[model samples]
Structures are given as structure tokens and as C-alpha cells.
Target: MPELPEVETVRRTLNELVTGKTISSVTVKLPRIIQRPAEPEVFAQALAGQTIESVERRGKFLRIRMNGLVMVSHLRMEGRYGVYQAHEPVELHTHVIFHFTDGTELRYKDVRQFGTMHLFQPGEELVQKPLMKLGIEPLSSEFTLKAMTDKLSRRTTKIKPLLLNQEYIVGLGNIYVDEALHSAGLHPERTADSLKPAEWKRLHEAIHETLERAVEAGGSSIKSYVNGQGEMGMFQHQLLVYGRKNEPCTRCGTPIDKFVVGGRGTHICSRCQRLPRVKKSSGEV
Candidate 1:
């Protein structure tokens, strides 16, 4: 799944490619992808002749703003959007097509068919499902040291699972969470409230630095993720520990270990991020 950096990269590319292009018509081959208006025909009709104002992102969702309506799209799993000439043949699993007035087409293709689209009025999206429950954007100015402290101070959940919760911090998936935790030299199983002030500061900085660098590299393309231009991200080459199981750690020579935490695959260098020792009962080993 594409997280913040991946989604943000797509938004930037789509804004450049599709902005100012009027929708001549819309075709929804897979009706299940449209969640709003409950009908694919209504969705196509509503978007017809509307000019695309801009493209924005909230967490993992894409907000494609048009004249009077906003289409909230979640490219779940392997969905991808590309701008192609009208004469080009549509590929397999191509579900949605936005025909532009300039003889170009904005096509949406999903191999898993799990992508979703919800239409709404201008301000209605923010107050409704999916978008409403999203927490602060990590890359936004609103996310500060104080905000991070406040969110983490009261939670006893393990750090990895807590960070993965979208209700607490949006845009962090398993990949980035593992990378961020590794970069901070913190164990994935550590409880949130157990961190000291110094550890908290390290974690805060790690999260920001990791995400910024990933965005600069166009996000990690560990799977089939691509931008609107059909280009793969380059950040995977710079990963620290997410997928490097049994590989030597970059900071230390310790072998990276893999395990399951909160039901998600987690990787870490045990030497770098040692788990806290638990006090045992007097008779127990």
C-alpha cells in the first residue's frame, strides 16, 4: 500500500498532468470502485464537463477537486493512475477512465480491484467517513514536538502498533513505521509511555527525517507502486532495515532480525534496539 510519501508524490504528479483539463466523459467499468452516489452512472454524469481544479491528498486518500464536487479516491493495494492518449489501447483491469477534452485520458487501473472512489460536495468530504477519522498529517506544520508528545504520553500500546494506527498518526504504514523505529534506535515492542524525554526527542526527529527523505526520493517502491507518470520510486534503495532481514545493520554491524509485532512483519537490529529487560519472579528464570 502507498503511504504518505507515495500518495503525496501521486498528488503532485496528477496536479501537474490533469489540472485545467476538462472531463469530456467518464467511464466506470467496475461499479464496485465507486462508493458515492451508489451508482456508477451518476458518478460519470456528475463529473462530465467539469474542469479539474486541483489534486490534493489526505493521508493515503486522493482528493481530486472539480468544479463543484470532490472525488475522494483511495488507491487501495495496487491501483495506479496514468495519463494516456485516447488512441492508446486500455490495458487489462483498467477500471475507470476520465476522457479529457484535449483527446487525452486519465485512466485508473487496479489489479486487486480494491480501490474506491467517493464523491462529495466541496466541504462534505472532511466531515464524513474515511477522511473524517484521519489524524494529523506528519508532514504538515501542525505536527510538532508538543503534538507528538501529547499523543504518545498516554498510550501504553507498543510503539510500532501505536504508530501504525491512522487515528493517531495518519500516513504511516508498516514499511515506514519499521524504518522510522529502526532509525530512532528503538525497539518495535517498546511501550509508548516507556520512552524518556530524550528517547521521545529522538523518535520525533527520526519520524520527520525518515518521511522527508522518503518523499524526496519519491517514496519507497517496494512493490508495484508508481506515480501518475508511471515511474517507480527510488527510495527503496536507501532503506535502513524494513526489508533487510539478516543483513548487517547500516549503523552497527549487528544482523537485522525479523519478527511479528501486532501481527505485522517487523525488522530491527537487536544490538541497536535492545528490548527492555523484564523483571522475573523470584523462582522464575
Candidate 2:
């Protein structure tokens, strides 16, 4: 799944590719991908004749700001968007096509067919089911150390899963979480409540720094990730620990290790992330 950086990259590319363009028509090859209006016909009708003012991103969702509505889209996995002339042949995986008045068409393709789209009234979008419960973006001013510590305080879940929870902190998935923990030198299995003040500071900084650098690098292309213009991200080459399992650690010569934490495959430098030995108890944290 694309994390914050990847989503942000796509959002920017989408804005550049299709902003100010009027949607002449919309075609949904896979009806299940549309979750809004509870009907495919309504989804298609709502988008028709709507001019896309801009493209925005909230967490991993793409917010297509139309004239009076906001179309929220989530590219779950293997989702990509491209634009081409209307007469041009559509690509193989193209699932949704928005025909523009200028003879251009924006195509959405998802191999897994897991991506989703929701059309809502502009003001009601943030209050809707999908966007209402999301936590703060890492780069937003609303995110601070106090906010991070407060959210993690009452949780007995391990740090890795806690970080993975969208309600706790939005826009984080397996890859970036692993990278953040490894950057902070914190064990993925550590309990959320087990962190010290200093550790929280480091973790917080690591999360922001990792995400910022990633967005700057156009995000990591670990899988079939690409921006709206079919551009691959460059950050994967700069990854510190996400896929370096069994390879030598970047800082220390110790080999990187892989383990399942909270049901997610995690990578870490064992020497840097020396998880504290704790007796297995009924609490299981």
C-alpha cells in the first residue's frame, strides 16, 4: 500500500494533470470501486459536468475538489492514474475513466481492484464515514509531541500496530512504519506505553523526517507504485531498513533482521533495535 509520501506525490501529479479540466463524462468499468451515493448511477451522474478545481490529499486519500463536491479516492494497492487523449486506446488495467471536455481523459487503474471512490458535498466530505475518524497528518501543524504521546499513552498494543492504526496516526502503512521505527532505533515490538520521554521525541522526529524526505524523493517505489503521470518514485533506493533484511545494517555492520510484529513483516537492525527482554505474561503486551 502507498503511504503518505506516495499518496502526496500522486495527489500533486493529479493536480498538475487534471486540475481546471471539466469532466465531460465518467465511466466506471468496475462498479464496486465507487462507494458514494450507494449507487453507481448516482456516482457517475454526480461527477458528470463537474469541473475539478484542484486535487488534494488527506492521508492516503485523493480529494478531487470539484465545483460543489469532493470526490475522495483511495488507491489501496497497485492503483495508478494516467491522462491521455480521448481517442487514444485505454491501457489494460484502466478501471475508471473521466473524459474531459478538452479531449483528454483521466484514467484510474488498479490491478487488485481494491481502490475506492466516494463523492460527497464539499463541506460534508470531512464529516463522512471514511474521512471523519482519521488522525492528523504527520506534516500538519496539528501534530505535536503532546498529541503523539497522548494518543499512545492508554494503549497496551505494541508500537508497531499502534503506529499502523489509521485512527491513531493517519497515512502510515507497513513500509513507512518499519522505516520510522528503524530510523528511531526503536523495536517494533515495544509496547506503546513502554517508551520513555526521550524515545517518544526520537520516534516523533523520525516519523516526520522519514516522511518529509520520502515526499521529497517522490516516495518509495517498493511495489507497483507510480504517480498520476506514471512516474516511479525514487525513495526506495534510499531506504534504510524496510527491505534490507539479512543485509548488513547501514550504521553498524550487524546484519538486518526480519520478524513478524503485530502480524506485519518488520525489518530492523538488531544491534540498533535491541528489544528489551520481558517475561511473557497473560497481558501479552
lDDT tens digits by residue: candidate 2, 81-189: 8899999988787899999999999999999999999989887989987999999788899789999999996688899999999987999988899889988989998
- Give the number of the best model, judged by lDDT: 1
Distance from true location, Cα of 243 in model 2, Å: 1.0
TM-scores for every predicted model: 0.97, 0.96
Worst 10 residues of 1 by lDDT: 145-154
The per-residue C-alpha lDDT of model 2 at residue 14 equals 85
Segments of candidate 2 deviating more than 4 angstroms: 279-285
Model 2 — which ten-residue stretch has the worst lDDT?
Answer: 37-46
lDDT of each: 0.94, 0.90
Superposition TM-score, candidate 1 onto the true structure? 0.97
Best by TM-score: 1
